[model samples]
Target: MKLNFLTLTPKATVIGLIMGLLIVFLGRGLGLFFFFMMLWFLVLSAIVSFIGKKYKLKRKLFEDTRGIKNVIANGLWPFLLVLAYYFLSSNQFLKYALIFAFIGSVAAITADKFGSEIGVLDGEPIMLLTLKRVKKGTSGAVTWLGISAGILAAFLQSLVMLPWIGYFGSAGISMLWLFVAAILGGLAGTLFDSILGYFEENGKGNKYTSNFFASVFGSIIALTIFLLLF
Candidate 1:
């Protein structure tokens, strides 16, 4: 099956172009590191769009924001994380490369899915903050489905990280910090996205604040786990 993301605006194209350049310049995995990511984004975008059409999955999140806004808000943190690893870490970049990409991409997609699906399933009005009944689609309104979605979102991302950075066999513990980092980082990132939704529900001025904070929180949580556990 083939899907074209031509529906994506020129701005999104520009964002891809710029990210492509960054991957080429700042990304450390290898010459193909950025190229592969570029292709991944293209393929994923197509897949998501195709699935969206078949399933009527609202492309709202990716669409609501401007292309540049979407990229910066959604893509920048993960990009930075990869760039940091490339420059700072001595480990083979490919070893953890897919892990990084998985956490970032899956977290965003899952968060959206959880939020939308759970909201639709639960007929009760929801308080995005507490998940107690308030109003359907109300910002901060959470539901059982939403929480479940959050867990799924976090888990899938963790899975992407786990295969390469595996857990201990005898002890059933993580042998590497990246595994720990990716799990905590993904959960934090998912929650952060939800928190942003809450702000919209509450009429907070700055919506992007949550994304910025979430990325920072995810990074800190990942690094903290890496340091304390490993």
Candidate 2:
């Protein structure tokens, strides 16, 4: 049988393996200190993508050249930011930052999954910001179901970091922080994503730059909130 990796573009598969090795094993250490979240991220992405495609919830926001261009344009900053955080940070903060950064990235990507899948399948429209009625899949549009799903996806991602970031007994509180961070961050990122969708027509390049910055801002915001509350 053909290998699963063969199904992915070389760039995608290479980056995936490199990211996994670098983040989980080398950067964070292994066994007890392993950053297993990276593996979960990969598995979750595949599952979400497959399920999303099966549901026919794919948004044509980026089509053909548009999709490749958008992914490349928007992804660079997050990629570099994570790399810098891993390489440049002291051991103490590096672990925390990486946790926050991974959570942010997961929330950002999977927000699209929740928003698209829930919105497309739902009967009533939900507002992106206010939770009121709006057009399905409209830019800046959101639904209650979608937001809940986003929170679910984000929380799962956040939970994977517990061993690396918090104490065993504190897992309950950590769960609280993870839930709150993922839900709020995922919502904020989704809203931001919608805003990008709306504005890509006028200045896609500018939107690309802003996307990274916004994600950083969202990550910081989530981390800060978690710290303050817990």
Candidate 3:
């Protein structure tokens, strides 16, 4: 199904502003960095959401606006990590890990959004697990277009967030290690989302939960890798 999103409803806007405030306030030293990165993610995701907009509208698969749930789903994990950073940042190791974890969540959401929105424009899709042909907007579906877009978004997200993350700092993590944690976490998280979509198609889950779990999963992946290397 084609769902359109870009505009945030008034309530969503209010909640989003609250979340932004939390990021800015809770981040303390990293406040500006989180604020700027969050804004950057918003603009990037919004642009991707606009792809095939005219076409999607005509096709009746677009919903035209996003609600508070959408905002919460997309922003919750990142926001929680920011909150965690406020409390746990005294530990140098956890601080850097939290930064990479934050990157993973943002990257995953951005990647998934890019994959779905851009993929819908490409052509028909096939289910990720079954490889059976499916509609272009079919949940759990895969398209080369979507895959490429997801990878690109993940890479770009990780690349841009590095400055905010401060290139591993005194935590002793290598830049390459951070990149591996982030980019791979994003890709894995997108795949996890599509797999969850399989359950969604069968009515076992919903989009909000899927998005939330996907972010958490991405964060875990990055954190796990970082810990492993540490």
Which is the leading candidate under TM-score?
Answer: 3
lDDT of 1 by residue, 1-230 (tens): 33324434576767767776776666554424434533543444343333334223442423322355655655676676657656655664432443344344435443444444444445564654576666555555566666665555455444443333332233234534444455556566656656676777667734455555555566556555534543
Note the residue pairs that clash in candidate 3: 2-61, 4-63
| Residue 142 C-alpha lDDT in model 1 | 61
TM-score of each: 0.63, 0.66, 0.90
What do the candidate models score in CA lDDT, each in turn? 0.51, 0.54, 0.81
- Give residue 70's lDDT in candidate 2 (0 to 100): 37
Candidate 1: where is the Cα deviation over 4 Å?
Answer: 1-7, 30-66, 90-119, 128-131, 159-180
Q: Model 1 — which ten-residue stretch has the worst lDDT?
A: 162-171
Candidate 2, residue 109: how far the Cα is off, in Å: 2.5
Write model 2 residue lDDT over 1-230, tens digit each, in one string: 32354224455566555555555434433322333544554455456544545445354432111233334443444455556665755665555555555466556555555565555555666544455666555555556676676667666666665565555234344556655666677667766765565554345535455455545555665767656654
Which 10 residues in a row give candidate 3 its minimum summed lDDT?
A: 164-173
Candidate 2 lDDT for residue 214: 47
